[model samples]
Target: MGQHLTIVDHPLVKHKLTLMRKVDTSTASFRQLLREISLLLAYEVTRDLELTSVTIQTPLQPMEAPILEGKKLALVSILRAGNGLLDGILELIPAARVGFVGMYRDPETLQPVEYYSKLPNLLEERMTIVVDPMLATGNSSVAAIDLVKKKGAKNIIFLCLLAAPEGVARMKEAHPDVPIVTAALDECLNDHGYIVPGLGDAGDRIFGTK
Candidate 1:
């Protein structure tokens, strides 16, 4: 994949994804596995972050230490299910700023509608990463990024556990400038807009909701 898309194929990531996809995986187990997988995905999502050096004295001698360039990252979770991934990523990057975007699908129209939004200020100065567990239809993900970009977020990345081809294509067409990092790109979306051979409704699975 080019800079526009990155599928994290680490052996451990694939193993955890398989476990999460199982129908019998317990709610607790599924949640835990998502947390574990998020940590792995975080590595790939942030692989290309810019770095700057700082002069520092080690215990023995002076050295120029490499430090992450720019402001602390801004992590925007596409609410509910996104929180599952956000929690694990926060443990790895404790200093990152957090934000939220809530979108609900309108049953009649089958389109995403924003109901809540809270984002960090100065988004233009930081790298923003949008998190959502499933990229099945790509409606909410695209809408969420639209809001983020409107608030001056130019450098952004989309992170998710699983992606469907239809969703990937939709995002590529809408936000080609944003890079997408996902654990696995599944076969395709079913008629009902769920991924085939993929984990079921991520929000329900993560929250143990209907």
Candidate 2:
């Protein structure tokens, strides 16, 4: 973990991200594309998962097979937008434990305010992945990770659809042990804290809200 960031640059991820960035893309289409892209990014996030061999019965004979090591993963979605990534990743890793952290940005200060948090027990023993669609200002992400850490989560990974340089730097400064995975790292954050050239207001787009 050490302030790492992985940009998933696969063709499929790039293509879908392009469509998702379009303002003309329908809400339904945006949601679907997010699901699709999440599936692909899931590959990168879980790429380094440890595997151990165990004795197993094959079609013809007994053999050793590789299986995931250690306890099941814990996936903590950072509220509404994170759900889009969580759903798709869960489909890939059905045995994962699920949690949710709800936080809202303070209008005046542009800070994070935690509203709800319910996480699984034994967080320290599991690999936790925190999902949020946009890492624009990173205030929410940093706050959300802080809450997760307080629950004893040790191995943590932050997953998102898009990110800004400011957000990435902020995350590095706050939590260097948590790695970040995203489809694209955008240029910078705007005055309103939106990622430039990003799929605007991921929560609004995903939920069809203003």
Candidate 3:
């Protein structure tokens, strides 16, 4: 919880990521790889979830069983592409509550503009994990996090597939307390705010849109 940033460097994660980066990777393959990689990333992010023991009965025996403690987790996706990561994480943590936040960039100012938001109630109590595939300029990410915080989400973690140095720095300055978990921390952002060496537009690659 205290770590500011975590770059998941597992071999499997790296392998799938390499495949995802290929321009020739078809939409179906890209989507499948995203789901596979997301499962691995979700494992790393949720590795430290608090657990408590509860008494349970097993065929002619009684014993204590470990179960997740405290309020159930809430998975909030930063719209469009975030849904790709959300679907895989949901497979791993099926019982988690889900929400969505939609935001688009302002072409003139290179800023984020929120268009939609729907969050769970009593967010202050539940641990919230926000998902997005690419953290480029981080304007939208920061805006999305701000919205969740306004709704009372105190404990929050951001999960993304790739991040630019600019985005990471921006997130650190804005929300130093929130931890960021990503697969790769790429080079600086390009002139148009795209992550250099990034797998192009995540939403486009994910949905086969240009």
Clashes of each: 0, 0, 0
Q: How many backbone clashes does candidate 2 have?
A: 0
lDDT of each residue in 1-210, candidate 2, tens digit only: 343899988999999999999999999999999999999988889988889999999889999999999999999999988999999999899999999999999878889999999998899999999999999899999999999999999999999999999999999999999999999999998888889988889999999999
- Candidate 3 or 1, higher lDDT: 3
* Displacement of the residue 159 alpha carbon in candidate 2, Å: 0.5
TM-score of each: 0.97, 0.98, 0.98
Q: How close is candidate 3 to the true structure, as a TM-score?
A: 0.98
The TM-score, computed over Cα atoms with residue i paired to residue i, of candidate 2 is 0.98
lDDT of 1 by residue, 1-210 (tens): 257879997999989998999999999999999889999999888888899999999999999999999899999999888999999999889999999999987766668999999999999999999999989889999999999999999999999998989999999999999889999899998778888988888999989999
- Better candidate by TM-score, 1 or 3: 3
Candidate 3 — what's its lDDT? 0.93
Write out the backbone clash pairs for model 1: none
Candidate 3 per-residue C-alpha lDDT over 90-206 given as tens digits, one digit per residue, 9 for 90 to 100: 999999999999988887788998889999888999989999999999999999999999999998999999999899999999999889999999988888888889899999998
Model 3 CA RMSD to the hidden true structure, in angstroms: 0.9
Displacement of the residue 130 alpha carbon in candidate 2, Å = 0.4
